[model samples]
Target: MPLLDASRDLIAAAARRVMARCDELARVSAAQSGIERVYLSPEHARVNRLAAEWMREVGMTTRQDAAGNQLGRVGDPASAALMLGSHLDTVPDAGRYDGIVGVLMALEVVRLLRDATLPFAIEVVAFSDEEGTRFGKALLGSSAVAGAWDPGWWSLTDAEGTSLREAFLEFGLDPGRIGEAARQPDELVGYLEAHIEQGPELDERGESLAVVSSIASARRFQLIVEGEARHAGGTPYDRRRDALLGASEAALAVERICRAEHHIIGTVGQLEAYPGAVNVVPGEARLSLDLRGEFDGARDSVWSAISAELDAIMGRRGLRWTAREVHSAPAVFCAPLLQDAVREGIRSTVATTEDPAVIFSRAGHDGMAIGAVTGVGMLFLRNPDGISHHPDESVSEGDVARGIQSLAETVLQLAADR
Candidate 1:
């Protein structure tokens, strides 16, 4: 397939539109200072409405799915769709781009292809939840779309003690009908997402975009260490059984073990000691572990090594330890056909004779869930310094412009392949 006519001015104008829309959505935060829009919140509803309105302006029909995902589509309603988009949800104190840019870029792609003919329809989705900041579970929206929603998630509560079911009701949705959100494999040709690279790989290589090879396999756990509370002033080091000490040792062991393995990463993001009193030794300590790897066996093996180290630490500290598995997902690899499409799409925009860069995403994405039902592909725009999940995360307008063209071309490439 020949490339689309992506003139410099047209790309510049589209990039500005995408950037301005991003700024507008960033204001729909739950916080007063930084951006934060969680699932089933007022902000989510507002953004969905806004996205729907934009979709309508592009002559596409829109709907808010039972799972609260915002969707828009153009072309024949009966045809299988080429789905494009990313999450609309954000983490606490989030950057403007992470998921938002992808949604906007999807819209731009639809706009660019408005005059082109294709075999399948185009659908843009703004997934309601991917960060899982409120529900503590990622990919809820996409999982529902992939027919993988867990019934037990309804009981999961937020920090304010609002259950997921309750939040759904409050957001004007019926929990019983959530199954309506699932899309059969026959209904979709494939899924493609254009997102800001959450890491520095592209920026480090001085490239504008890259084709995503695969998303990492991940597991999360809540760990607890138990011990007897004692007086801080009178308890001797030999007599004290400190839960905090045991948990601390476990965290260090996680870092050491993960660092020794290739492409495995472990983080101890949350930690707390019970009784939180300066005058008393902690009776219990709780911490969270997020482990990810390029492969499932490697990720699981590292967890086993960490578990053995935790056993040794607890034994030495005279404490007891336990772990609760909260979440797990296997690695999702991109289809070779989609990967080639993405590569050619990216190569079309660059001036280089070399092939465009290819990368494996270490972070989680909705593709992890959608991959269950159909082929999945991703195009990543550069993120300076690899910063994300924070306010400082950034992408240049030029990169976004190229990303918009690249994604449009990718769709054409897919259409030609079909």
Candidate 2:
């Protein structure tokens, strides 16, 4: 893609608009202080309406899909579309930019080329359930679009004990009609998403943007450790079998094993011990393990090592251990065509002599599901310190400005490719 004639001032103004819009959406959250917007909730409805209004402003037609994903399109509606945008749902206490920035930046891309003739139509989607904060199932919205929705998901309930089927009805949607949201493979030319880096790669490299090579393969498990409970005061150190202690050691083992490997990550996010009395040794303990890697083989290898270490720890403590797999997804690699488009897009906006940076995302995104139906590519903006999923997560206005231009350029590149 050739360098765009768009002036610095034009890009700056658009970036400011994106920032302001993010702040506006941040207020539409469930939490009293922090940000928390889940699927099929009132906040989801409000944000969808707001996105729809913005879509209309950009001369695009808008609608809410049967799966409750917000969508907008411009150009020839009868033709296949090159989809842009990302999820609108967020993790608990999520920062403002994680997914919200991508949706808004996509709108800006549309605004930049609303009048330009294209080979295909362009569509923006604000996926309703990417975080899985409510239903414990990620990519529900995108999975529906990919025609990969599982009937089993209907029975999944939220913390409030409301089933997904019930939530759909409450949100004025019919669960049976969700098939309407799925797009045939030919109906989409490709999907491109712009999002914050959600890591420190770009910021540390002093670059504003980079092309994502792939999203990490992931495996999540609930690990349980069991040991006999005994009187805390009466039991000797060698005689006591403490489940909590064994579970703690297992968590540390996960970190140790993963740390020794390249591009592997392990997190023990949640832990709980049974038998609440302080005087009593815990009889049972459970913990959540989130393991990710760039490749499935390496990821599985790390899991084996961690499991072996767990067995040794448990055996030494006279305990038993087991793990129940909760979720697993193979890595999704970006299509060569889309990746080239994004690479050229970033090159057009930068003055550096080096080629644009490329990274494999350790974090997951809607693309993981959308990739099943069509080619997918991503551009990531610099996130300061990569402090995501927290209130302090941040992105600079300057980076946002670069991101808008890069994305707009990427659309042009793809259009040229077609």
Please tell me which predicted candidate would have the highest TM-score against the true structure: 1
Q: What is the TM-score of candidate 1?
A: 0.99
Local error of candidate 1 at residue 6 (angstroms): 3.5
Q: At residue 110, what lDDT does model 1 achieve?
A: 92
RMSD of 2: 1.1
Residue-wise C-alpha lDDT for candidate 2, range 1-418, written one tens digit per residue: 3546677898899999999999999999999999999999999999999999999999999999999999999988689999999988999988999999999999998988876888999999999999899998888999999999999999999998999999999999999999999999999999999999989998899888999999999999999999988999999989989999999999899998999999999999999998968999999999999999999999999999999999899999999999999888999999999999999999988867899999999999999999999999999999989889999999999989999999989999888878
Q: Ten residues in a row with the worst lDDT in model 1?
A: 1-10
lDDT of 2 at 388: 94
In candidate 2, residue 86 scores what lDDT? 97
TM-score of each model, in listed order: 0.99, 0.98
lDDT tens readout by residue for model 1, 1-418: 3479657788789999999999999999999999999999999999999999999988889999999999999999899999999989999999999999999999989988898999999999999999999989999999999999999999999999999999999999999999999999999999999999988999999998999999999999999999989999999999999889889889999999999999999999999998899999999999999999999999999999999999898988889999999999999999888999999898877778898988999999999999999999999999999999999999999999999999999999999888
Off by over 4 Å in 1: none
lDDT of 2 at 224: 92
CA shift at 104, candidate 1, in angstroms? 0.1
